[model samples]
Target: RRSKDIRFAFDRVFNEDATQEQVFAGTTKHLITSVLNGYNTTVFAYGATGCGKTHTISGTPDDPGIIFLTMRELFERIQATEEEMSTDLSISYLEVYNESICDLLLEDGGRGRSLALREDQNGVVVAGLSEHHPKTVREVMQLLLLGNKNRAMSPTCANAVSSRSHAVLQVNVRRRPRTASISSNVTVATMSIIDLAGSERASVTKNTGGRLLEG
Candidate 1:
């Protein structure tokens, strides 16, 4: 008997032993630089329940994930060029639950009403979504923790706290050069970090009836 072997091509690959920093350096490091220069970027996670999406994107405080690492790098870069540029940063967090969009960072504490989607020349955006301008890493962490607490969740057979909704964290960074010129263009860019709900089979999650539909 003979066996066939196959080869695959990829921009980058990581092994189990790879650290969180290594992953960020290889995949997301360049995006930060581009974002600083006025380019929008989005990083999302997708897979089945019990997969490593949560672990990779929002790891524990001790091991920090991409979001926190990215924020740290962004602030560092901003500080490094403070003399040459002025930057403004704002953030908004939203969750899609049962086809409804809810603002996670709403002043009313993720309550009130569901936000509406609107579109114009730029693209589709959540209408009247709450935006928070956080100045420091601590403030950003506070908003992140608040948003996480607001995400829909229910105990499942596969996991204790299974996320029942998709959460998106968006950051808008606007930069302008200090020196004035005839064509001093302003740069506005955005970064969206999404933590998507994982798929769970009815058999695996042991959901049934109305619960099955919800799952």
Candidate 2:
């Protein structure tokens, strides 16, 4: 019998020893800074079930994750320039399930009202989605928690709390240089962070009934 070998290549790879700070420094820090400078950006995580998509995007509170870290930096930058710049920050979260779109930030008691996706000069946009402007990190985090509680999830043999839908969190930032000369000039940018549901094989997940349908 002969053994087959596999090989793969990527721009960069991190092992178990890679700290969350290190990962963010290498991957997300630039994007966060760019958003402040008026560049639209998006960061999305994709992988198979039981991989580390959620862990990397929304890790434990103590460990933090890309979302928390990026938001913190944004607030910090705003504060640093608050004396000379006026900044507006807002957030919106939503999920796509069963080929239908649902707004997570809606206070609709988890009834999962289907929203419509529209495309404009901004590419794709969700019509009638709730966008929250948070003054502090605590407020933004609270909104995130509320939205996450509405995400579609189910248990499977591959992993517990397996996501059944794709979730997106978008942060909108508008900055105005507050000088007496050009107080009306504003620069706007957006950052969309998405956490996609992992794909699962029926045989591997061994899901049944609703779980099977969800997977």
Candidate 3:
């Protein structure tokens, strides 16, 4: 059923008053719990360029959004269960620009790298990105901040600021087998949070900067 809001001509789910924290709380409970069934989940934000997509994903350091909240909750759960089970956790963040993949961490000597995911009869492989090892929640948060800085952000009218490219955060989880005798029963899971490049209405933007050219 479609209800028309003639003023905007489109139905809107969230409005300006929505807080980043509120959004995070909703997603943390829903998405993080489904990670155990060999499934992958993505949270995407789409709106005109200059909209708050970037803010929605990676809000200012003082303000935390879904990405931060999700990471914290997920890792916190993992930590809580550590006493009874053995697990290995790894996490990494990457940026995609014009179809190119760049490493957010280890940039000192790393050249721009491209990442890919391909699967055949066996499984999926994210090319150009090796599995990252993240032990504590704090460590992952640090890497996220580093990655957020490396992302391409610019000013716009749709919002005060916006994201120009896609950003991806990947967390990999592997459970240690009860023992070598029961190693085959061990399970693995992965979760990805993607902050997408906003959908910009060129005319509304006035299209001056490269954004105009790209759009």
Candidate 4:
């Protein structure tokens, strides 16, 4: 479902099936423009376990999954727009483990309390969490792998190394309009790559070891 306030996207305009290259090119172009104009955006992924969340977010860099594609598109587009405008992009990646938030790249560093569920003034979830800043896509990707390595997992009759935590990879794009003729407010856009924990139960998983340790 689309948010009532957000009315811009590449897939909606380009129609991915129509032309992948042009679509990719166009989306990157919009992202660059949005960043310069002070508009924040987020590309988030959500779904049940084993639904290709990891495959989508952290796929091989060469093969290029969504995150990689977006990063490449962003930098490439920014480079392309260097003649006209300038922009800045920052990234942060973290994992929610047993309701606790931790830095994916740091050595097991986290907060005092676990993630708490809360609502903002608008009654929307502001959720409990702390975030870290990542400078490069390589840093973000490395932290993702680190988090995956640390992710709670277990063996069942079905599969091995099942993800036991929810991971959130966030990208914050900051853009300042060059001229006052247009809206000059600094705008930020976000892209969130979320990998959720598995839905299987303890009984179903018959978990032990790291899983039991998580238990």
Every candidate's lDDT: 0.84, 0.84, 0.69, 0.58
lDDT for each residue of candidate 4 in 90-195, tens digit (9 for 90 to 100): 6656667755776654555444444455776434332534445555567656766776665555556435656677777666666554553465565556666566
Stretches of candidate 1 off by over 4 Å are 1-9, 107-109, 181-183, 209-211
Q: What global local distance difference test value does model 4 have?
A: 0.58
Full ranking by lDDT: 1, 2, 3, 4
**Highest-scoring model, TM-score:** 1
In terms of lDDT, the poorest run of 10 residues in model 4 is 121-130
lDDT (0-100) at residue 193 of candidate 1?
A: 88
Clashing pairs in 3: 49-200, 50-159
TM-score of 3: 0.77
**lDDT by residue for model 1 (1-215), tens:** 88889888988888999998998898787899889999999988777777877877888889988888888899999999999998999999999877778998765545658889999876888998888889887799899898888887777788787877788989899999888574788898899988888786778888666557665
For each of the candidates, the C-alpha root-mean-square deviation to the true structure, in angstroms, is: 3.1, 2.8, 4.3, 7.8
Model 3, position 19, has a per-residue lDDT of: 81
